[model samples]
Target chain A: MERIEIGHGSGGKLTRDLIEGLFLKYFKSPELHSLQDATYLPGFEKIAMTTDSFVVQPIFFPGGDIGKLSVAGTVNDLTVSGSVPKFISVSFIIEEGFPISDLERIVSSISKTAESAGVKIVTGDTKVVEKGKCDGIYINTTGIGDVKRELSPKFVKPGDVVIVTGFIGDHGISISLSREEFEVETEIKSDCAPLNSLLVPLFDVPGLRFMRDPTRGGLATVLVELSETSGLGVRIYEDRIPVRDEVRFICDMLGYDPLYLANEGKAVVVVDRKDADRTLEILKSHPLGKNSQVIGEVTEEKGVVLVTSVGGMRRLELLEEDPLPRIC
Target chain B: MERIEIGHGSGGKLTRDLIEGLFLKYFKSPELHSLQDATYLPGFEKIAMTTDSFVVQPIFFPGGDIGKLSVAGTVNDLTVSGSVPKFISVSFIIEEGFPISDLERIVSSISKTAESAGVKIVTGDTKVVEKGKCDGIYINTTGIGDVKRELSPKFVKPGDVVIVTGFIGDHGISISLSREEFEVETEIKSDCAPLNSLLVPLFDVPGLRFMRDPTRGGLATVLVELSETSGLGVRIYEDRIPVRDEVRFICDMLGYDPLYLANEGKAVVVVDRKDADRTLEILKSHPLGKNSQVIGEVTEEKGVVLVTSVGGMRRLELLEEDPLPRIC
Candidate 1:
């Protein structure tokens, strides 16, 4: 029955109680306990920083809520960038009159996700806007990590092979069905998760050229970027790219392309051809990567081309328009 | 006439163009120029981190806009915490169809502010929500700085002097008048500014115990917090507290307490009583601190007390409700 009031974000007594009763109880870090203006941390030799804002609609999706997505999204960005995420700062913008119980639930999710990812929630801020000024809730998480290695397009060569950590388009499809706008029913759950555990170990592996999360623009967009940045071509096999039958079915029914749909928990990695099989074996050994596949390879040409099962070639371009909004 | 489309946030070609054409052009830094998933920076021995989300309405207001406020808010937090801010990460959540021209103007403001604050915009993210799902725009800024000194209540002691850098409640009054809900008009402007260049020098001054920006809950809440946290009493003179006549007139008309109102560009500093005069002189030497005053002194008693001009005593409590929202 408890509801948030404007005072909860007024940086006053109510704000203090909410932080102590909810956030402090959930995110138990020594740095946060100090409640200083800024969290002071011991610095590393080199650090990586990234930021993301999650405005996912239908806050509670099949496999994840906005809290989980917020943490996972920032952690995955650090992970794919060849860093070990160590700290995260979370800021929330909530609408007035939102349920305190729901906020607690989201806070719990953020705590669990950060724990699983081995990152600490060190500092944060909260603001409340009057009704209709904002959506239910939006979370912005900024992550800092220790840079373990340097990964860049310059290291990617023509003979490098492209590997996707797991099936693509599940997240995008799951979100679509969750909206229930199309009256379509399916049991596909979002692949929303942190990639630090699955991808951080690969930083030590030899021949890792570059890695990036296939998020908003999906696998095809990542490949196109890789090609353009490295000035090398990419040739992806349409059949080799793993897409779940349920997801593909939903995409087909909704006139969507699985290749350009978003994925929350997958990574597109480019590795030297000589180490491609080793990388695949290492990836498949992990539970989150059980469905991993080597979907394509770098080429001498200068554009992204798909080799279809019909023995025809088609070029893929960066997505021009959005089919879905606020999908994380 | 150009406006943002849903496609601009799709992480596609449009997204690339926006980043390259708009963001990159303004936020010029080597780390950002690399266009990696995360920004890599050389680490310091110790660092301070903070985050804040700005949901200020009207987008633009007298003296500053959301962009300036976003950068200054985070930078000031670091400066008050005894750090030299070095980098900032900006993230935007914009509603679809928001004017690109307005966005560019905001970006220019951010660029200028960051440049003046001597911090680099190292990394960022953007998301666009459907119409009616959000206000025009919201910004979140996270800052990382090198810790130059340790400022905490643990170092605060009885007999310390409390100094407010300038006037209070200007930002709160300015925002209220700009809303025009009461149709009151005035030339008052929001005192939204970055305080790094002004306050960072004080870190070298001896006897500086603690400092904090009197932001959302104003000087009263901050003093109450200091009293509670340090287990020391504070007795401030009402006559010494700086309040502009224009701001006071509006507050009197609106039934608002200026002490509980917000300030965007001020700091409440605690210093050893012996060094109070020297600190005041130093503060008065700066343009931003010409109105600096020794407002009160730390006491042996355990609560905040106000000595009224009429020789009566009054007590100040932590703000219980928000008189204004989104003032920053």
Candidate 2:
């Protein structure tokens, strides 16, 4: 009805009209129209839903694009819950004058990702803003899955050993290196791989406490969440945490902590000490989890502490600030 | 890490990074990481999952914003499935420099909508792009619910009477009129409201068939889809379809049909003729469906046909081109 500009995306009355008039028009599914925080699904013994947004600069990075990440990230969220990731709804916001080629590529990537995950892209959306309004692209993917196993966000507790699926901070570091405009002799790669394959074995274990992928804010944030959820503390030794040499070097040069950087294809698992050894063994056997390590143990205290390499103790706070803006 | 340009949202490699890095980081629910299409959720029972996107220009229209629409649209989708709305996930892609006030309004709207629908925004994501990349804001919301009563996409059949929930084309007409360039006064108001409250009475009917909302591509697209999915055709009398006088005048003036124009808060129901009268009665009582009307009948054919006001017949083809480009 009007020439769209960046202002339209603002949460003003016109924005509302666009959603009501255009979005709701094509996607008439009832669950979405309620405009609720979470769609209450009554029939399942367990339910899984996930939300994710892409703010990657360049839209496509060295290894993957926002489209792939949007789907993968959402599916993994559901997968770790031991739910079968079933449906995903994608939303895309495009700036005007964007090349159609890129849209096709992204859609193709989404199709490929969906096929790989054995899911269907039943419905999706696209919106366009005028030129000079926003960045290149941003993607939001919400996923739904049905709980297939007896899993609970309730099992994590103190004294459980923490296991990381693979090497840490590759994703964040790779992006940083590319963005820093610094010359590096060593080649670095992002660990943006799928985790469903790795989860297959972990689900076979009966006493697995909890599992979460460490993306933005990395292992620190997830461990803190685990502790807060379980009302427990966590203690991790700096020496034991795995870090790729390239990531470590970049962090050193950038004065960053690999611990706090994001990792695309990694997970941090908290399990009963009895199940700890088996979990690590299981993770190490998988390609995605090749650098698997025992990063920490749940603590009885209410505060999260990091046992340093110098034997000094300090707290690992929730990443107080975005270490690298839009690294995801 | 490069200053995001419009090319990134083009759906290429850059889009993938934005997704993998940012989305997976904050939202990191396992199912999300799988990068799937339709998530392979567990159980094939009566579950409803709906997807909608908000690309409203001038977000925060007269009555609502994209946030409200994000939640409302999803809720309506589930309601159409004869399910009580439950949970919703929200995702946002915002351009840099957008005012925070508008976002608060939109988010507040979401909270309000969720509360009203008795659903939760269990998960959400946000992304900020540089200027010149996106409009102000765009939202994608996905809603899921458990169907209490038996419902399926194949519920429509021959001998079923088509019932519309309310006046048609109000949303399209209102939005068009509301646009900045449109310089005419019109009493037409967008029909943007949740329909879950109206559905309770009709869902349990002895022979209620399929149900859907005619949003985008309007009534014609919805009826065509109904025909295809139900393996049945439909014949509608133009004179019987409900349209506010002002809306019809606006459409006529603009060379648009109420059938092809969008309706925000509306639905098309195919119910047993035995229950058609009762369905109309129930719909008429609900505030959201007060103008409910019987519009057509399902048939054994495979496509939709519209009987003109003068008794001539014309095939109502599904929309093949983007009418009202970027209308959403």
Candidate 3:
């Protein structure tokens, strides 16, 4: 009867009792137990501050895990706004039955990733929940920093050049094939990696019109958002778009679009046509951007189009149905 | 087939795919994707920011919910030392087959709780994972704020008075009976509530030694922590500690001690005797504190001790095990 069970997560009276009786007693603080949506500081600027929790299933997929994804997800949020990545707090909700060896491995990866990106895990907290009550483990990370640069939708012009940091859908396809059973899967590794190193280098360059990581809905979605945000149309050369043969093959077999498959280590940066070559060159030297390319150009047209390999043009549609393997 | 499922929670390829495909693309920024442990921001002070994902079952538990618990858990860490609660970002990992009505209810509760404590939900992200792949639903809330206040261990005083707001053990026992069939069942309500209104009002007061909310490990754990932190012993009166009849009945039947129970709507304030009366008065009038009382005193004895009803003293030992009721 005293044993912990899955029911504790019921959000019922029992949940509260556990929090109030045991957890809260030790974590005591008025602001903490205030139980608000967001903690109130009584002072903040006109800027936006946000935190996100991530629990991606695998610790290491083709591209990422709960750890790296947790970090990348937060960084991308700040990056698009021209804000620099800053300090982060990492908390792990480890199940009692989780493998300690795996955790150590994950932590080492996290440490290495943070070091490469030049951020620090200034503080950390850990909690162990009973098995079945949680997945193997969940990682929640929060980040805060200053937005030193100014980025606006206005900077995106109709004549801008649309450049991608590297190949699209590698991370998604790699992960999908790795996690699930599939035929015609390729030997592609995930494109999961950090982009801040490239981001800082790019900020010093001119004509950096717009930047976004094509993560979830992939290139199409990101392009759609930018077009909507910038009130501009976009056209792309399908032949020039970067996609590993493995990724393309898998997407074709599964009826998934590489354009919509996620990429952890890639990004879409819009720069002026004049600066595209320079930008591409700089990105190429970075390991994550070695496959960088100029896929398309921004336009004043009202819709998005892709030039087919046969020289025909087609409209790139918005995502309507869930492409489950899109994450790969 | 596109629905997010339990397998996606496996921390494998699909999880990576999900983030890269959906989450990363839309949330992309130049500063993100370094896949690091912590992000570095040069200007502001280094902050350890974090977000938590919770899917506690049985929404209307004896104490709180995934919503309230999410907020409390994050804020507690921020309030653990240098900072006050400032801003938070929330994300929802919802189960597709779960009840939308319940979701709405949880949202409303979260909003109300946040508003009451003056915190804003400012920004949030939502995603639908498949049924069973997730518990009913999971919530990820992240918070950030300034760490201007100095509540370090050095602030602890040897002769401080330990004031507990209202009762203990009720929250845990209530949840136990409500969530599961226990050996000795009793109907007891949880003390889950926000305590900032009471505590903030006392911030400007003098001789305010220290404060904590006895949550997971309850009063016993918190006192033990204080003893270690301040290098001072604590002496608490058994009679002075508050306990409700229902909680006592259930604990007695289960061979549980009320002192170690969790509390949401409670706090332990360490202050000098001079500020004790003023502190109690302020706490008594608050909605969360109808039965505030002085339960113990700090001592030079260097550990945790309880003055028993038989006029004999006993040491409060550390907890060796966890009381878990979890929802993945």
Candidate 4:
């Protein structure tokens, strides 16, 4: 098997060959084809920019690999921020001796994911480290998008409704099980799809106040952050929150709180009570959001409180320690 | 010493504390203060985008650290492309148990370097891996710059002059010596400085055709690339190439070619013969470019050639292997 060598990252002939033969072939865009130090993008009035680094273990997962996750992760960030992602820049730090075939597979995944997310791979960089200096590969992606709408927690009001786009905690649960630390296995895969298309239509709805992807710290963390930042209160209903049975079972067995687990492709959206039903209708119309549900509402109280099915109120605090690392 | 824990990158309370306590304190900007998923930048007609991942070993070197090198590396790429760097996104993949003090020092260096480069650190992400899965830290910076001038190898032509901004191979040599593998000692320091202020002036100079920073593959590699890409010949005189006495001494002892070693703070420029003197004068006026020299000229023949001090003609090839890795 062909393995990467230090020369492949030396920015020399080997680097050139790898780029031209592998990356350029997969990421076919005029901006990248020019092979300049920087890619020039023309005509932008207002832009949104976000970045993320993916160091998830087990490069390949059930539903997605690091390549797909990296692209979707940034795209989802921009999407939640009410931006239309346009171009993305990817950089990689690969360990020497990493398989060339694995790299090609990842590159192909990146291309396909970027295409589906409706973004162009404009520029990128690659660096290789000595064998033990790095894990197999770590990818960093920065996305640029056109600001389509202004979304902020400041717009959230006491009577606003909170809606989750899909079943929560699937991604976190899938990664945990993939580690094989527990002998339990299930068919649940990560919900690591890009939410851009599903959520873009919601930007047209009136009273759309704020949006956030429940990624690393999950739905509860995002709600807590929203409550603190907006200086408002949140009241979520435990029974209304959507979670797959398998995820809930695994979380229960592992002593994890599904509400605090990560979700790669779901968004916690706040909209006016008057437009909540309309927003839900729009979200539920998309396949990615078919499991959408109104889970909570903004309140005059000051903290994030979950009203359980048994009529008990529990306060949700920001996560103090990680239950899982590199779940993204 | 306080050390980074996996919780610090969990995107929860600990992550928030780290961001607010360190990154936000240093990277003071309204865009970052918003803490939105993405930063919004208004009013851009044309922009240049570039990304790079820095994994330089030793973390700290004589003149700069990985933090400083990361910022300067991306900023210089934009500068050479004739852009005014305006916004930068930084992401770090850190190892668990890495010293927080070291991380803070690196961040301080990054903040200082970004400020000096006239760019805003608008958005970022942090991910931590298990202790042995990664080196101390790796930084990925993607920059967005306003395009002030169009530059390309397509504009280069025969009879154009090639100018180098300063001494070659300082960064590579400094890194090699820092490794302590050769039992050598020297006062040499890496020339890891941002070149925007120095090179931005040349953008206004008429007849300037192309510019590229001689970095990973160094001056010879850059010149060879220029020759191949522009379909023009390049003939550089060894006598005209600038090299410090210490650098020359180290290279001779180590059996390394200074021409192929990396430089962090220098640019190889191609310009019209009629404006060569003016370009040289302008470059010489800057402290960073005091050692600037017109070392070669574009020729009608097809390959890169070196005219040795003894008047022997020798061809230069693109570097096939790196003499030093992670020199940044």
Candidate 5:
């Protein structure tokens, strides 16, 4: 049974062996082997660059592994930011003694995910630390994309409507249950996915002001940030926010709110009220966004207020503690 | 004294408090606070992007800490790629129960180093894992730079001269001693630094073919890689390679070759023979490169060979294994 050793990250023969044997074998791209310190990309006047480090516990989850989540996380960040996700750099810090077979599986997932999204895994690095110094592996991916439209909260106005692309909390709950720390079981799977194929086309819709994927801290944190940044209050209808029955059941049993659970494949969009219907129509046509709904609207006031299903308006404060840590 | 809890990385209120009180207080970049999922950088037709994950042990090391190394590592990667280092995205994966004061100290160091390099830490992410799941902290930085010139080994020919920017092995020896695992002591200082300001001017030099900072694998690995990539051999004079006496002594005591030790603030430049003298002179004028020297030349043969002080030629192999792990 071959396993990853500390020598694999020594930047010498073993490192080269690992790269050529595993990484290059999976990420076979010209830009990756271009023999330059930095991967060079030509022809882009303006660019959007974002980075995320994936530290999910139970590296292999129900629907996806760390590799898939790593690629999807960075790609979604760029896509939601109004950029056409093009190239990404993936770096891995693996703990020694990790099975090479698992590493290969993860790499294959990264390749498949990137190919499906039409994005290239152009550059990468791998480092192996001693056992106990790190968990199985942590992946940091930074994505660069070509800007297609302007998507900033600055364009979010008081009359704008807020829309959610799909069901939330699946990823958070899936990762949480995978740990088996709570002695619970469910068939729920992570909503981990790349959204460029779904959201990039929406740039043609007029008045599309902002789009962001709810990952850590989930939907509530993003809405709060949007409110603070736009100086406009956000009011969401609790009934309108979509949640799967299984996810809702787990949240209720655990005293966790679905609003604060992470979603790897969901988008919170803000657009002109006149364009909300059109945006929802555009989103619903995609498989990932089949449950698209107008969940809220921007208000003239200055905080996030949620209208509960019981017909009571209450403040949805920021997530104060980590109910599910390392959900990534 | 408050320590960093898992909540700080929950992407919730504690995360916001840490960002506002610590990260924003230090980073203070407009792009960082622009309230966007991905930082937007405007206007660059062609760009170089590089990413490195720093997991140096004993986070605080002699001459430089993880903060300084994180900045310099990515910035130098961009610099050697013939790019003017511009923007960087930093992500941190910290272990829970880590001291907040140490984290702040690291953040402050990052601010100072980024400022000195004229690069912006435009975006960042923080995640905290359970205790013992990771080392104290690991920082990963991805740098984006504007290409100032085309510097690649494809431009190298048989007559190219190899020039090293400064003394080698100081960083490796310093870090090795800092660990104190072997009970060896030395006064060597890590040569970690940002070299764009020092090397950017040399783009004006005629026949500047390629440049690369020798980090993890040291000069031997760089030369070997250059040989394999350019299809040319490299021959270096052992006497001509500059190594500080303290570093050499420690290497000798430990039976390690100075050529294979890591160097944080050094570069191996490949230039046409006609421009070697001029490039060396330009580099030597900078304080960080006062020991700049031309130690080798590209040969028609096809491997990396070192001429020993005893007048025997021997192969300088790629770093076989990490003699000193976490040396950065």
Candidate 6:
């Protein structure tokens, strides 16, 4: 019943109480309480570090909230970089008058996600602004992961095949509806989740070339980046890429390309043709990736081209403008 | 003549353009473009990691802007934790209609500060939200530093000397007046500079026990925390503590305790009495620590006690409420 007051982020007694009663209670660890400005991570020789600031509007949406999105987003970022997430630092900017209950729920979600991903919440900070100065809460999660191998476009080749883990655009569409700006409704849920467990199995595939979570610019953007960075072209079979009917319907109504919509829980993997079937099988075995499919292949050409269902070809260029701002 | 649009944060073409044109133009480095979701930090066996979100109002202030504060703040956090600040990840949440010029200025400041502090801006993220949903901008910086030695409360003991780097309350007073909420005005400027250079010397002192940048809750709050955490008492002579005349004058008029005001560029160091003189000498040699003074000592009792200017004793308790929010 104790709602969050401005004092709770004051770096004073109330802030300490909130951290101890809520954060410490959930994220109990020795390094977390090292009583230093920064937590020490020992034996991290070659580590992958990434940072993301999640500012999704409405805070919560179908299947996930900002807390879950934050954890999954950073973890996926690290996982795609060929590292298993080991530690994370979660910092929050809470608006005054925000409900403590909501914060508790968010923290609980973070704990569950971090636990599932086998990452420790190591060090963090919280700051509160006056009411109306900020929305509800914006979380910045920076994670450090243990690198098992180096993954980069430098390793991507012309004969690699692209695999998408499950349906795309669910997160973007779900969050868009949650905002209620369009007055439209759907049963679509966000695909927000950590792909580390699902990805661990695919690392064993010797032909694995590239992996990336198409979060912000979705599948097309990732392909474009891959093409541009690695100087290789891509050809995707549009009919092969999975899109939930509800998501496709919403996109059609809005005239939005599903390829450009953000996805929180999906990954686009590029592997050699020889290992494509095995990679797809590994992804399909995971509950979150049951809809996995081989969607495309890398080409010697210099741009991303999509083949239509009727055998027509369309160019999937980089996203030019913002259709959604707070979709993440 | 260009301004930042919502598309620039959409993580699409415009976003990519912004990164290449603005961010990469200034923060260009190899690690930044490693083309991985996360940058790999090699040879970091023992490192310290910390994160902070800076929402300082009026992004540009007298002595520093949000960008400089972002870099310096994170660097100081890592520095005080006994680490040589090395790499940083900068994340920004900008309002859609924010001026591109202001952002350029902020980024320019960040580049200079990071360069001076001997740290690299390795990874980053940018998110744009609709205007009015957020203030002009908020920056979150997470840093990784190499830990040369362990710094903790367990190292503190009775008879340790408490030394303050320089004048207290300068940053708080300067920012308070910058808001122009109070009618009164003064010439106080923010003491906002990176203290890593000033601190490297003290690390060599055999008796050095603890060091912290007295930021949000200021000197009193830090003393209370050190006392509580170490299970040792702190006694400071009020007369020996340094406060600029303008800062003290403003504090007097506003009925604010200078001890409780923030100091962005100052440090509170505790060292064994045997090495107190040597530490003080080293600190005073640095420009940022020219006014360093030994104002307090650790005691056998277990709470913070302040010696009044009138030969009286006053108990300094933990900060109860926020006198000012978003000061840094």
Instruction: Categorize the docking of model 4.
Output: high
DockQ computed for model 5 against the true two-chain complex using alpha carbons: 0.83
Supply candidate 6's per-residue lDDT for A251.
90
The residue-level lDDT of candidate 5 at A221 comes to 89
DockQ metric, candidate 4: 0.86
| lDDT ranking from best candidate downward | 4, 1, 5, 6, 2, 3
**What lDDT score goes with residue A244 in model 6?**
88
Interface alpha-carbon RMSD, every candidate: 0.9, 9.8, 8.8, 0.8, 0.9, 1.1
Model 5 per-residue lDDT tens digits across residues B1-328: 3798999999888988998899998897898988466878886878989998999988998899999999999999999999999999999999999999999999999999999999998888998998999999999999999988988887889979999998999888888888877665556788999998889999999899989999888999999999988899999999999988878778889888889899999999999999888898899899988899999899999999999989999997787798887876
Worst 10-residue stretch by lDDT in candidate 6 chain B? B180-189
Task: Give the per-residue lDDT of model 2 (tens digit) for B203-282.
Answer: 77888877777766688877876776678899999999888888887777888877878776888888889998888888
Off by over 4 Å in 2: A1-44, A82-86, A94-101, A111-123, A128-136, A148-156, A178-182, A204-207, B1-45, B148-159, B181-183, B228-232, B299-303, B310-314
Segments of candidate 4 deviating more than 4 angstroms: A181-183, B181-183
**What lDDT would each prediction earn against the true structure?**
0.91, 0.69, 0.64, 0.92, 0.90, 0.89
Cα lDDT of model 6 by residue, A182-246, tens digit: 76656788989998999977778899888999988889999999999999899999899999888
Best DockQ among the predictions, by candidate number? 4
DockQ scores for all the models shown? 0.83, 0.19, 0.14, 0.86, 0.83, 0.80
lDDT of 3 by residue, A1-328 (tens): 2433333333333444545554344333343454322333332232334355555555577546667676666666656556666555555555555654566556666666666665545444444555554556666566554565566556888888888888888877776777677656356877666678777678767788767777767888778767766788999999999887877777878788888777777888889899888898899888878888888888988678999899999887656544652241
lDDT of 3 at A264: 79
Question: Candidate 6: TM of chain A?
Answer: 0.97
Q: Write model 3 residue lDDT over B303-327, tens digit each, in one string.
A: 9999998899899865654353442
Candidate 5 local lDDT, A1-328, one digit each (tens): 3899999989989988898888888887789978466978876978988999999989999999999999999999999999999899999999999999999999999999999989887777788899998999999999999988978888989989999998889999898888876756678999999999889989998899999999998899899989888888999999999999999999998888899999999999899999888888889999998999999899999999999999999897788798999987
Q: Quick one: best TM-score, which candidate?
A: 4
**DockQ-best of 4 and 5:** 4
- Per-residue error for A318 in candidate 5, Å, reads 0.5
lDDT of 1 by residue, A1-328 (tens): 2998888899998999999999999999999988987999987899999999999988998999999999999999999889999999999999989999999999999999999999999999999988887788999999999999889988999878999998899999888888886666677899999999999888978999999999888888898898899999999999999999888888888999999898999999899999988888888889999898998889998999999989799999898877887799
lDDT of 2 by residue, A1-328 (tens): 4334343343233444555665555444454454322333435555567777777765676777777777778777777777777666777776665665576567667767766776555455555566665565667777777666545436767678888887788888777766757767656777776577787568878778677778766788777656665678889998898887778877888899887887778877777899878888888887777788887888788767889999999887665456676765
